[model samples]
Target: MPQRERKLRGHFSTPPLLVEQVLDACGYTPDKDLSGIRVLDPACGSGNFLAAASRRLLSYGKQVGLSARTLARYTHHNIWGFDPDPIACMLAELQMHATFNSCYPRSQALHRLHIHQADGLAFPWQQCKHVDLFLANPPYLAAKNNDLSGYRSTHLRGQVDSYLLFLNMALQVVRPGGWIGLVLPDPVLARSNATQERQRLLAETTIHHIWHLADVFAAYVGAVVIIAQKTPPHTHHQINWRRERWIDAVPAQAADKVSLPLQMVTTVSQDLLSQQPGAELRYLLSTIKGTIIERLQRQLHMQGNSQTPRTLACLGEYVLIRRGEELGKESALLKSSAPQPNELKWYPVLRGGIDIHPYAIPTASCWIAREQIVKPLDRYLAPKILLVKSAGRLQATLDTQGHVVLQTLYMLQLSANPTSQPETQALFSAEDELYFLMALLNSRILQDYLYALHTAYKWVQPQIEQHVLAQLPVPAQAAYTEKEQIIDRAKLLMHACSKSSSVVELKAQSYELYEEQERAICALYEIALQQRRVPDPPHDVVDEGVSLYG
Candidate 1:
């Protein structure tokens, strides 16, 4: 956006301290070279970063024993800004002039600061090559007013975000190894779906520091200021987990310390190519020829139907249904009182879907058993039947407490336990069935797939149908053992992460564990998806038996 347009629209300029903190994180030194250092603030609202840069240069010049006139001349020539708001550009120029006059009231040869009213997204940046630092927070508005479709078309396919596109423009204007910093939302850090864009940035840049300012940027919650060095695109490399948040780096000794509440911050970067080898297993598993359930059926046939077989019903037979909309209370109780003799008991219910709040299992529902109960299915007897909530904002795993029917926010699937009691009937399990199912549901790949599907029908009401849920690919029996192992490992990591004192350290360790296991799972799933055969786990590590307290 142009300076004039920004001003016309009254977009608030970033506070000066925010700019200073960002620059400091980028390793700015007051005594560094000031001459020929071109700085561009793409969304230079009122030129806050630009003005700060000028001041820093002046301080730097003074520290280096330069004359006032020399400092004034350097500031004018080095500092520059661009915004779509012409009025903003004019105000910025005024700010720049004022800053210069403070340095050299009598100097006549000071170069005027370059401020322009140009749409940065479409601007010709090639002329500004050799830019040293790209600074400023870009506008956060969606590309299209109605939906993110425009954003998908214009930015995502280019393997870039709006800010990233601006970064690309800046990179075009900068010399190799130049620095870039911007304030962005958390989605960019760990959101798994934007593979290509993440690949492009990771391939071409080095993220030096991330200032997680979730508290300070509360209006723009979950914000982080990313500091990166621009490098030429090259072969992928192993990504690192850096846990130090921007907030931690700030000190009491700095001239100005802007503190934000500690929010969870974690960073991970891995060689995209290197992951392929580990993911080979998942790939193989995903490509397998037949449905996992079907494969299990075949295995059952091979076993000569050793156990009693039962068909899954239309779902009405085993359970009753209650929609979230039916509840008049703010939140429903899982244990409602017995209203009549031989009435069904209510039990806890869980919904099925991604939840924004992690670890939030749905506890809001009133479930009841049928008045005249039919014999429980063979499948529901062991490991407890899950009252999987199919609708609402979250998806979860449910446990048996009583004769409860699932809410609309559920998936009526069954999970098995390997350790069956003497009274327990053979529920049928290839191996590690529970962990395998969890792995399929929790994989980043599956999350992305589901998210994309959700986005496609965003115009429609938020309703995920049984057909849609059924269509999701399930890995076959061959990979079930491997899938189980992966999920077990992931569960351990998650448990470990929850106990750590530092969000950064915990997430770092968590992701490392996640990456290792996820790749293996992905490779296995991939193989299954392709209808190819999969190898068994190299060893029988089974469950790690990591116990979680609280």
Candidate 2:
């Protein structure tokens, strides 16, 4: 995107303090030889990176007894910048000119500093092959309108983000052992579309460090700055990750003083990240959190047939997941504003993210004809689970009352095949199974799994995708007593939810029971319970029989 467009849209430009931090994090400073660095910002808009290089060169010159005029020539020779926007290109060149003239204290405009108004993605191969450090904040645009035929990720017909092409470009541009620093939207770290690029990154570079901008880029625009060496990751190489956010400046102090907030750091082995399923990297988890996660996913031998008897039963095998569709012809679909008037067989539609709460459904003000829906009507009419897709966590309810559901939710239909596991078939009827599955999906334990594993992806909208919901771990409650207990609790909550009389007391009772139900499901999954100390008769309040969890 052009800098002009970004300013018009109210998005942030690179802060000077942030530029300094990014430089330090990537080992780019006056401590290194600026003349030999050959820094390049492929997506430079107003040349923030080029200016950083200029500052470093001037600082280096001061230590070595060289004048600002001498260093201005060095800045003119070494830094390179490119942008597709001609207006942006002129501004970037002006930015470089301003940097050089700052110490000279001149009003003259400088020209011809190796900066070009061309697509960096299509920069000359000869020049790019010699770049030492590729540093830039590329556009967060999609590849929808561009001709990506020349890029590697798009060469094989793979659709990718525009920033991904910049990453691919960096690998070819930066020399071996050279560094690449990029400020990217957070999805680049964990999205499925970027899975191949991440795997390639581990195979081709030693990802040295990351800075998670904890909502400084807006909560919806979660972003991170990644620094890596072009060299392949070696065994025992660890990745440094830190959490940093923005803070408001005090009225008494300079604004720059509070621009960089306090940071929390963690280190994880590069091998561990490579080992993670699909190479999906996230903020490093602590030991206690890691241990708890391990237990949640640990394979347990439940009562079943001998084939893969020791494995934790897969959730994907039990149900067919269907994503709801968008209803654009609302005027045609609308029959009445009343809730399921039914006089003309019109059903109320749930089209909002907040339409369904845990174990409950709110009254719908919009009614629609079933025949007007574009998707297969049976999926919405069948006994299924309604999971809100656009939530930070899983919000689900079992829907036996056939409602016209829209794209904001996912409709889960329990697959009842005869060839399925005998225990699943014998233990559950079609509707009973929906309740059991609903209980699991709505549990606090699985909600924790969703966040730690996938759905809480900190970029864009964290909507629950169909594939992610299909992979949620569901314990095979082989014990008849346990299965019945979950279903009974879910039923009690649902029963309490449908009534209109004594709303206050019933809602309170339902929530209290819901929490207890979450606890029971947690126990079923062997999730660790917090330990407490009980006073011994005449002794100190010391450690008692605590849990065996880490």
Candidate 3:
């Protein structure tokens, strides 16, 4: 299929080995009885799961002394599949025929297989009930791009993927005791957009296992395989979550070896997941790290204020925040080499995240013509803070040169009305306030808080949102003596960082100073950090072998 069509339809074929894994997860063992077992693949692309399931049932039938004709009849009647593509349905039917011939040769009876071309989401549920297993890799379309009006409900809203809707529909059609094994995108479990659906899934089903598969498909999209049962919500049940690294290429032979190295991250209880507002199953954090981080947040919430500790003034309250302007296709404005004349029109431009750091920018390689600069040109000439919008940590630096910055950076300037109270102006000058804010923004405590709240993976590329930045707690009317000391220390730290020889040395020196400042800030905020062991970094394993089934 063409790439464009595949994207529009969200059609990606499952590898045979992965199909076998899903079947195994659904409890389709060859030793078990094959009679009266009904399997349905809602989005059965080319019938991979159906083909695998049919072989398993036939193998079980042979073990139980069933004749070839009877086994073929049972296979045709028991297994059900649905796909929107007629060609895929035909291909799936062909696969089933091949499976029947391989398992039960010389069976003259024509098998009436239940594979049809139709939208699984719109399939009439009244026609089928008591399904034993529902296995699928449903279409992956965003809600806005596709016609999902039939599937839309309160639980499914706001850019929810089509696979999630398929999962929900499967739950409704499957019997109470039946199982659902699906391969879905990872965001379904973690993204805030899927909060309602996640909550519904947790409340309705008992999740047996979840495996995070990194780069499992040809497109290298992050995915997860969830094996869950349609059971009444059981708060005490523990869900197993594991991470696996699969080899990139499928094995050539059925007997070939494939490495599926697995790591047990943590098992979470349904009660805890249900209690969370989003019901976010964030298993990325290890047991010790999660516990300690939660404790710190709770302490900050309880002890930081007498009445409402959760409420804190955002950074925006004290500064004007604006994103850098994008210089579109105006090649004349930017020069590869220095201008021949050092005119006022040529100003240094900071164009990327690499040029930004904690307290200083290391380099400015490009210069822009000031005449072509976007609106608010005065912002480029003011003493302000520059923050890299797309960095894992808060990459903020003091830009005193009035350098023009590209869209990758955000500019922060002190608000025009610095203080509403005239008496408070004497306590801290604007420069002193900028230094203090820089110190807090670059602190390890604030970094930890942002990471815990916004990221799901250890090595996340977090984009600092304006609203999130504004929530930083500011000291309310501090003593002049302590405020002056903090400002002095911040100034020294900034100077030392700018003078450092290399990035590594600058980070080390900056961290040492940040820790010292954090202690004083913690005292002012009345927050305490508990001593705990930091968890080991997550393991990244690579294994080269043949497929598990092969």
Candidate 4:
């Protein structure tokens, strides 16, 4: 395929091994008669899947004692495929013919190949409703870029992806109780934009398994293989969600040499998935971690005296969270005019997340011209917390002078109407509250929770959303003694961090003080101390459970 055409159509060829895996998942084997089984690959690129399926069906026919002519007839009649690219359709037909000829030399069934040069998305469903298995590696183009107006339906809404539309099409064309195996982008399960389509899919089909195949493509596009069965409406069943490293679906050597461990797997109830709007898919977590997180939530709720456990209030209730303003053409703004004499009016512009650290802003690296400033200038005049929006670890610091933060940071200030509720007012009281909240935000527990919730893949940067921050658990009301002790420790740590001459020394001191403060806070919330421990040094070297000398 031409590079430009491939890019435009999202044409990534399916690996033969992955094709075999999908076939196995659908219970297709070479030892049984598959004459009645009708398989359709909607976006059959070069007929990779059809070619494989034809070989499997031929093997089955041989095992069932079918003659060469009967096997050839079955291959030509049982399998169908469609692709928009004429070249792809031609290649698919050739592949199927070659596979059948290898199995049955006397049979002349090349002309009966069902591969068609038709757009799968727009194919007439009424003509192909007898499909028993809808298997495909659909195009990955985003809906906005691809004109899917012809495939649009009530279930398909918002900025949909072309692959998602193909999934809906497959559901419609597959007969009741038939199977569907599709290679899809991993985000189809959790992205905010795909929530509606995901809901519809869950409501209509029984998803048997979801195999997350990370970095499976040569292009390194994160992909997943979803195997589901079309069923009557209102059907519900537990979905088996599994995760693994790049699937070595094809063994490089002997089968015994391969060690493909199941990284994680869990059965998820439909009711559980429906409870959250995003269908957040907590099954992705290991069973043990999931249980621990649930227990932690329950423990926090029981802290309150009310019969109904108190849920953690979102951070938005007590604080105004906003992304820093983007002052376009920074070079022009800085060079166009000089600042006035008043230092208060001439605020320093934060360069990026690197300039901010826990409880401290490293230096006044750059200055913004006051006249060129945009709206929310008042935000730059008050004390607020600056959060690094794109860091591996969450980095936040207090900006007492209200510096002009760049777009890379988020500004968090006490809400103007904090007095609207007693809880809000209590949480935002001056110096102590901010210090305590900052301590909790940077704690070990919250850090672990954030990683579980936000980190999708190791290569992807983790982000903090306003809604996620709001749900962070904090003490509903801190006692005066606890508040004073926390504020005092936080202040000391801030002072130590600012005065340190070496970054290494600063980090060591900060971590020590943070641990002390974390213990106190965790105690107040009745949370057990589960801080990760450094491994102890080995006393002696052991070889096969025996000391070297022994």
Candidate 5:
């Protein structure tokens, strides 16, 4: 019979700065606050944080005039740790002993620590119900082994991700009004749709700090540490409450002192929105859509079957694809099933999806083209923005081509105005329409909004059908012209960048020519494309987590 192997888990040491910052935020100082600080490390692993906390508390106790023996006893009893790995629990205990002995060399009880081998997420909460501070880098394990209930569901419930589940469990173990600090992937904060519990957990607590540590994890994935204090309001209690705000981390400032009232913490991206109240421009566009849609309906009724301009594309439209569906031995072409002919002048050939972060174009043969094509304005069809609705974490790449290669994705084609309708001319300049369309896709605000909505609704396996696409709020073109110009210039910059044979050779030139506006867009897309979760804190300070920590 084969021997059983231990479960593989992501267990690593917490960075030293993280430990100090978390402790400081919780008012647990080595000498000032450690004597009575009741701390727990839920996913203790090798007790990296536990060992560090023990050292700090021991030092604090000694400085506060506690005897060496008393300090040892307090260190063993005051701090608690739990881990699912028996070996890890033993290792953590050993580490505590080593750190404890260093503080109290003559003490005998220092060798026995309170670290235990048990699933942190599964431990009976009554065991550590009074835990004042919960600080941990929990073992990230997919809830497996028929052990998915208990604390996992109690905290996470509908959340499919284990990291999120662990976060909830950690919060549950911490006493009310106590502090909880944790390191987790960036998405939980920004991804539009976090499980209800995640949003509720954040909304419930007073977040103190958030730190965006670029390339901190070996996964080289961006990470943030959230320090929170649980202080929810009672139904009838007269308590002043506010939503959480994000802060950027600055090295010089003390981590414990970071707090801003929730009312003042509106998302910076909201300010970037194109629609400002009382802007005449939006009213004009609103009037135009109403006029155009109404005019087109009448014209379509009159024209009957004639091919009046039925396609309405947002300006700056990038690629139009000729779709051909081919299985194994079938023709390798995605032939369009639309009533428009292969020679349809309105819909041009576009090939999308080949690393167009900042900029992209279709491969030579990949461009969808009918045999007959001539002149830019002759074709009336416009390419629609269609994203590959997949569950994968990879940054959704640009499908410069109009056709979607991925299965189950939606194809968006603009609804054309009837040839008789004069409103089409007033909607936007032809070139401007395409430009506007591309700008919307490239906008970070729109992307984030889409991402949030996607996350919130992704679990439903939403069919990205026409109704869904239609529901997407369209920003006013005139309101976003400045942003559009930046995107257009970036697109041009990227087009120029494609001239280079390699990224290495062109990187410096790319930076030198790129302005701040373009660079911001590039940085955001690159970060988003790589699935980095670091929240954009507009201020110079780094946010360790949600700013609800007290």
Candidate 6:
């Protein structure tokens, strides 16, 4: 199929190992009797799942002493597959036919096949028998107004996707207390916009296992295997979360037949996830430090002698944080950094990337004409903070040079906190206030808090949006004298960072200065860094069995 057409149809094939792994998770192994288990694949594109399941059914059917005729009849009614592509449906039917024939020869009965070429999203599922298990790798596509004509679904709400609709359909089709094993993208775990889907999943079903397979589909997305049961809410439900990684002694040159290497990292109570924001399933959050980070984020600092505890003042109330203007097609109107004769006036553009670092702005390497420059022109000229949107740590610098920053950087213009008590905030001058805030933004505590709240995967690109940064907390629990000391030190540190220094000496000096302010900041918020204890292996784990350490 053409790439565009394939994308429109959302046809990403599941690997053979992945197909068998999903089946094993669903209890469709050869050793188990899958006689009464009616398995289904809604969007069965080449019948990878249907064929594998059929083979398992035949293996267990004969082991339980069933004749070929009875097994064929049972397969006709139990194994089901559906697809919108006719060619794909034919391929699935052929695979299933061959699977049944390979187990029981001369049993190629055409009437026993139930695979259909139809859109699973709009299929008439009520006419079919009860589905005991739903096993599928559904298509993933973001839902837009023009994406599907007259497409309306209950699951389609704020910022929805096509995969969510398919998952919801499976929940409704499968019988109560049935099993649902699916290969889906990892965004369902912590996407802020997907709160409703996460809530519905937790409210309705009991999640047994979630395998985070990062980068499993390089061309597609980071995938996850969710093994859940269609059962109502119950107390004391625990989810075994695992991570996929290469084994220690395994060589990278190994053959392709080796399935995903699995490691049971940790297991946590469902209640804990349900209580968090977006109820995110951050599988790596298995320590006291993670808990402490959560507490620090929710801590309410005192303000103006108010007896009732309240949230600290946010950065948004005092700063205008906006993304850098896009260059668009106006790049053709620019000039060199040295300034061309008689050309439009050129101003240095703060090109984003590895240039702008903590307390050090990149020297302008390129210039753009004022006509090409976005207005209000003073927005770029003002002494502002240029913060680059990065993953591992915070990167920001004071832009005193009035350089126009390009896209991928956020310009933070500081203003006095409107809600602050005059007696409390009047201690610092305007310049001092800017420096103090800059120090905090580039501080270690804020970085850790942001990562803990958003992700555990440092390598993964995070959603560090303007609104999220605007919500950065500012604790105002200090006397005027203490605030002055902090502001003075922050100014000196930023000034020190602005000068040239060797990489080694700069790192050492910056760490020492940052630690000083970090201590003050932590003291202000009453937070301390909690260490992550190393886990010891349990002795009770059997051979090849995953250990449980919750």
Using TM-score as the measure, the top candidate is: 2
CA lDDT, candidate 1, residue 288: 26
Instruction: Please give the distance, in angstroms, between residue 285's alpha carbon in candidate 1 and its true position after superposition.
Output: 23
Comparing 3 and 5 on TM-score, the stronger one:
3
For model 2, residues 1-550, the per-residue Cα lDDT tens digits are 5656563432345656567667776677776666677888888877877777776776777777876556766776778898877877788777776666765666343445878888887755655577788888887766665556776447675678787888878887888888888887788777777887788888899998877675554325666788998888877676888766654334311422343454677776666566556677655433223344544443321123235433245566788877766864255666545743446767767765546777774446577765667787787778888888877688778777787787778888867652246354576678988888888887767777777667544645677777878766665434677778889998887766643331212466577787778777876665222221111222221111111111
Model 4 C-alpha lDDT versus the unseen true structure: 0.66
Between candidates 1 and 3, which one is better according to lDDT? 3
**TM-score of each predicted structure versus truth:** 0.51, 0.84, 0.77, 0.77, 0.56, 0.81
lDDT of 2 at 399: 76
Clashes of each: 67, 0, 7, 2, 53, 0
Tens-digit lDDT track for model 5 on 1-550?
1112222455556655556666766667764766777888878877778877887787677777888778777877788888777878888888888887776677786645688887666556656557788887764445443344555354434434557666767666677788888877545543333345455554466655544444444442345576768875232221121222223343322433444312322221111112122111011121222222223222323333446432222221323422222222123443434435545432323322221233344222332334323323222233444343432211122334443232333333333542222222354454444444444444444444343333322222223333323433332223244445554664555455453232212256565544554354444333322231223333422221111100
Model 4 lDDT per residue over 438-468, tens place: 7766666666656655545222344566666
**Candidate 3 overall lDDT versus native:** 0.68
TM-score of 3: 0.77
The residue-by-residue lDDT of candidate 1 on 365-442, one tens digit each, is 334343322334323333332323433122333333332333344334342332222111133242234434444555
Q: Residue 538 of model 2: what lDDT? A: 25
Let me know the TM-score candidate 2 reaches against the reference structure.
Answer: 0.84
At residue 352, candidate 6 shows an lDDT of 63
In candidate 4, position 488 carries an lDDT of: 82
Clashing pairs in 3: 254-550, 255-550, 256-550, 257-546, 258-546, 314-470, 315-470
TM-score of candidate 5 against the unseen true structure: 0.56
Q: What CA RMSD would you report for each candidate?
A: 13.2, 6.8, 7.8, 9.1, 13.6, 6.5
lDDT (C-alpha) at residue 398 in model 6: 74
Candidate 3 residue lDDT tens string, 361-440: 44677787766687678888888888877765676777778888888787888898753222343667777777777776
